[model samples]
Target: MDGTTVTRTPKKAALASFMGSAVEYYDFFVFGSAAALIFPTVFFPDAGNAALVMSFATFAFAYVARPFGAVILGHFGDRIGRQKVLMFTLVLMGAATFLIGCLPSYDAIGWVAPALLVLCRLLQGLSAAGEQAGASSLTLEHAPDDRRSFFTSWTLTGTQGGQILAALVFIPVVALPDDIKYSYGWRIPFWFSALVVVVAYFIRRSLHETPEFEEAKANNEIVKLPLGVLMRDHWKDVLRVICCAFIAAVSTVFGNLAIAYGVLVGLNESITLWLVVAANAVALFTQPMFGMLADRIGRKPVFIYGALSSAVLMPFYLLSMSQDNELLTFALAIATFSFGYAAANAVWPSFYGEMFSTRVRFSGMAIGTQLGFLMAGFAPSIVTGLGGVQEGGWVVTAGFTAVIALIAAISASTARETKDVPTAALGLTTRRAQRVEAATA
Candidate 1:
């Protein structure tokens, strides 16, 4: 009872989550861009038509390590705390990303180059698996009763900032001469993550634990085996969140495949990079606005609307890419990613975290989201193996986005709306109602 109010913690926790996620996702998204644009030549030179496939396969290796990281990190987060796990993940990611920059190319080390890249990528995945879940859970637990959705929305706003930094940094690197570009330009971005690592570590470390977790500790009700508790008590919620997390595949299609497709079709590369920058800039503004709207209205309407809108908008955007009209492409890109995608992106941290109690929130979110995002991790390679960026490839990719978006919409519909739920009783309706009545009186 000596702790700060929920209103104060939400803003502080959201800021902490925002900075931490910005750093982690900056490392993660930059690699996705590198995999699409540069890795084929540097790491997989011998594969001819299979070079892209090989590049994306290397990208997918990280997803393989994520679920395992989720289980291990999530256990400790629920047992010890959220802030500690986030700090651990940040260090792990920073080291892996920096090591990636040091990897020798195929010309220097032959096949060992790609293998080392895969090993580092797995470490990146392991770090990321815990980053979002822990951050989201921390934010959600600290948020005020009526505005949980709005506060937790900042966790995802951090991701848009990361994407923007990733694209902006790579924009220049893409313009470098092949020798310089391949040799040192790609490495610069990875190395720069050290600054983010240092700044974010200090910001996150200054924060206190969430009130919900603190309360759970006071009651001696913290679960020892959080994954087991999550499985036994909240499996349905986990499954639903997994389905919802699959919508993340759309990001790979847009960010990674769009870069590959634009280059293959003879469009200018800078334009492609700027497209991501522009869309994310719009999202930086749009996501928080939508989050506020979710607080006023409800999470489901905004979430479902976003999923359906993204599913519908993907075709227009992908079709516009075929026409080679930069204006049309930018317009459609902004519409699809910033407005449409931000709808779901802004809401999910609150929506998904509210589906479980604080006792198992981090474990539940990490395991479910890591498993679902594994599908997203491989989407670009799968699309490439089908065909590289033609209309047929676009059609297949669009269909994939629509199906997953629909699944996310349906999954969100299954959860109870927690807009009015108190932070101390997020997954418990009766206790929340009693708390609200007591507060109101």
Candidate 2:
């Protein structure tokens, strides 16, 4: 190793980001699993389909909080630093999730149970508002110049880990007799977040700030209002990111809503959970390979292909789930998620993060993506209202899925190809780009 080289820093940064994201999403996914499998029964036993809609609404409530959380968290993340903001997000998510485990059910507390659940979901939303953006920004800045996508991919890969863990846990809990499952099996997952949070917090806290942030601070380039600079100089890119992020709705549709849809269509609860586990487990390996492909080719083709392919394949996956053929459903789940959508999932960290300068990268990614994710947060409820989970229900959701994917692909198409751009010169303003070009010349 070279004398001045901090050789282990990149690996450490990726590990920290990965671990932090895993814990954050683990708590988030726990709530998602419960919303589908447990909330309708435990929190609103008497309302019938209205109860399911209401339960999904509580799930969507976090998304409503997300954009707002993004603005506040993004501000501090950009100004105060990504590391501190991420630590706060981790702790906030844990507290909210733990409280959820303690909340009483509708049988005991009526509407108050769901209301409190919504409140905790809002806190989770706020914490999630910054998790991906902060982790991606920190990882992207720390990574080797030529391998940004491969390294930053771990941040999102951690999310797959979280989802997989969430599903694996809910699998057993969902299988218990209803008396036990509803009584306490569900709460176990939420309470377990306390342990995961403690582990993630220590790992994240020990990580040093990225060198890019330090350089910006030393040069007095760090702005007091990163949002202002981001708006003034990078509004177009922000909008692009927002549209592209709509692709996230596909994920929510697949991982969260599909569980309910499976149960509604008569698949066993554990089977649905297994579908999630299978897709995400395959994604754990496929995502990094997609990341490597992004680095070798470019972010554009891989992301665009992923977006379009997931749209094309989602209908089949949903339709397969509605059928009696469990084998076909499982196969479609892997093909749709692992090979198709995972392409976009694996690459967006670098694709989005590279669009801004370090001074506001966190805010830009956080605010933009959170705004777009509103569609995701509300998708299950919206599609459920549209009869998305009923027999022959694949059409409504399939259409919704395609439109969002088109929006993302179109948005991605508008951006300049950025694989060749250096990390420091990324997201340059007109003047900044000219200055960089002249310096190179």
Candidate 3:
């Protein structure tokens, strides 16, 4: 491709990536909302007081499948092409989500109800394991050297869009009478995922494979076993990404655990869902700005700021819910999530993907983030088990947030600054050597 085509491809890739991620996370977040509000009653009715924990555990099941999914999907992503693998993940997630909507309730089917729910959730997890990594890698590769972070930021911004869409769809469902809400209102959002999947599917299908991957393939640099190459060369980067990825738990705490906590603290269920809608709505705008900022200042500082700010602001946000002030709660929610945690969320696509060469970038990012995201996946169950959704659970939740944020910050601080590096020079030891190799080729 020529320079103009190359330049334009990034925009197309970014849009396709944004749509795919929106569809993927929309399906994922719908399940999260249902797990928090509906599944305890619908899927785990027999568990008594443990029903909520069990419901959240079903939410975690996808995370458990994620690492394995990362290995399987990431291999094909690197081996075949990012575009093809992404198409499969999008369809798989949509099918699994739609199946969950079709499942019988625990009342009608006994243990088979929760069993089927877990199975669908695992499929969701498997699809998700590759979605972000593939989207990020593809967009980053297509993006200009100077604008990679800004372009790739849209992938995460798409996630915020998904969360907003999910919460909006569920808000009315939560307001329905119990009989209707429990009977079928919950399934509408899950079924709505099918429509979105079709939309994103066509968008992604029209986009071409990334130029970086194409160039690498043309030069015979594609690896047969990407995992082996990743372990042999980029293991430390993978470790850093895993630690840096712990910040994702903050999202679970905000989106899932906080909803249950708010209800526990006397906020209405719809109000809690509105809070999610509000924070993520603001994030739709803020995350991209943070991405541009990362491109200018460097990824580490922006990511670390996001991490530490989340730790500092989380307690105040949680505390506000019990203060009987809706305005205060809303303000704190925006500050804690949109302005604080969003910075790290926005920058990680570039920060992590830039660590590996195009050859293993998919595998490295997928395996690393999925492994770390296990904490994010199980965070609701773990914190709730420790009383995060109980009367005085905010303290436990806040402390957990602080610990993960600090660890992510410390890990991020150790990473190399790639803000000034050329697109082709990234992952190589030095710019001069990269140029020499290019000339020799």
My TM-score estimates for the predictions, one after another, are 0.95, 0.96, 0.97
Candidate 3, residues 1-441: lDDT per residue as tens digits? Answer: 233233339899989999999999999999999999999999876654489999999999999999999999999999999999999999999999999999999999999999999999999999999999999999999998788999999999999999999999999999999999999999999999999999999899999888888877777788999999999988999999999999999999999999999998899999999999999999989999999999899999999999999999999999999999999999999999999999999999999999988889999999999999999999999998998888889999999999999999999999999887766767776765479457655
Residue 166 shift from truth in candidate 2, angstroms = 0.5
lDDT of 2 by residue, 310-333 (tens): 999999998887679999999999
Model 3: how far is 69 from its true place, Å? Answer: 0.7
Lowest-sum lDDT 10-residue window in model 1: 1-10
Q: Candidate order by lDDT, highest to lowest?
A: 3, 2, 1
- The best candidate by lDDT is 3
Models ranked on TM-score = 3, 2, 1
RMSD of each: 2.0, 2.3, 2.1
Off by over 4 Å in 1: 1-7, 429-441
Error of 2 at 83 (Å): 0.8
Model 1 Cα displacement at 405 (Å)? 1.2
Evaluated at residue 374, the lDDT of candidate 1 is: 86
Pitting candidate 1 against candidate 2, the one with the higher TM-score is 2
TM-score of 2: 0.96
How many pairs of residues collide in each model? 0, 0, 0
